[model samples]
Target chain A: AQSVSQHNHHVILSEAASLELGCNYSYGGTVNLFWYVQYPGQHLQLLLKYFSGDPLVKGIKGFEAEFIKSKFSFNLRKPSVQWSDTAEYFCAVRSFMNRDDKIIFGKGTRLHILP
Target chain B: GAGVSQSPSNKVTEKGKDVELRCDPISGHTALYWYRQSLGQGLEFLIYFQGNSAPDKSGLPSDRFSAERTGGSVSTLTIQRTQQEDSAVYLCASSTRLGGLFFGEGSRLTVL
Candidate 1:
């Protein structure tokens, strides 16, 4: 079994302020990491994902995450956030070793961006 | 379908009543998942279907909750004798073996 842990439950940031949400996972084998976002009154959509290759991965809306294997972390970061970025973000993981293993989600971080 | 589709966008039912939520996955997706999203709980996975067979149903909260998929396309989640605590958004997502999920708008159920 695999699990995800999000360090922050809620985050408040002002417009143009930098943001970082920490995420860690517990899995012993190969895995695929993902970041999903849900805007107010909207469905959850993919922000970004890391399968392999470079540690840093860029996503939509100028968001990015770095997969650091040593720390078991894949933290989401934004250089400058906008008010429209307010939403709930979830970190998820799936086992690449077991194709049947279902993806697991963290508790989620609710981000509030002030104008 | 162009994307995952869930039905009964909103449902208000009395306690003890039964409810059924439907999910139609994106065309040709081999993996389908059902999740429950409540305030503060994030996404609580309820079940996973690989094709028409479910391999992991451990996330289902209770026996009153049941789900099934047919022809590897449409899935239905049934809650028998629903309780007030069962009120939440039931979300359905579809994906390939290694692809990210494509989520539906979700079916919100409110038990009174």
Candidate 2:
């Protein structure tokens, strides 16, 4: 079993501001990490994911995340955020035990981007 | 030209009633998942189906909740004797190999 923890419940940022959301997981074995975004009135969409390669991964809309294995963290970051970035972000983890392991999701961070 | 699709975008049922939500996964996805999203809450895993077998039902909150996938494509989530607490957005997602999920618009269930 795996679990994910998001440090921030809500975040507010002005336009063009740099944003970073903290995410941590509690899995000792190999795992797959993902960040999903759900915009207002929209379904959950995958932003990015890390399976077994580089720690740094880039996603749609200029978003990125760094997988720090030592810290058990995979934090989402963006150099500059726009008003359209307002959405709820979730961090998820899937252990490598079974090919179809269940993904554990965090409580999600509601991001409000003000112009 | 296809993605996951769920039926009855909104479902309203009385307490203690039975409700069934449907999901049509992507054409070739081998994995399907069901999740519940409460107002201002995170997505809670309900059940998972890989192909035709479900290895984990631990995410189901109670025995009243059950789900099944047939032909490894379409899925149905049935909640028996539903409660008011079940009022939330029931989401369905499908993945080609459990890496990235393509989600449906979701079926919003309101237990009144």
Docking class of 1: high
Per-residue CA lDDT of candidate 1, range A65-112, in tens?
A: 999998999999999999999999999988755655789899999999
B15-69: candidate 2 lDDT, tens digit per residue: 9999999999989888888999996679999988887564468889999999888
Chain B global fold similarity (TM-score) for predicted model 1 against the true chain B: 0.96
On the 0 to 100 scale, the lDDT of residue A34 in model 1 is 95
Worst 10 residues of 2 chain A by lDDT: A95-104
After the best TM-score superposition of candidate 1, give how far the Cα of residue A4 lies from its true spot, in angstroms.
0.8
Residue pairs clashing in model 1 are none
Best by DockQ: 1
True contacts kept of 1: 0.76
Candidate 2 Cα outliers beyond 4 Å, as residue runs: A98-100
Residue A91, model 2: lDDT of: 96
Query: What does the lDDT read for residue B107 in candidate 2?
Result: 99
TM-score, every prediction = 0.97, 0.96
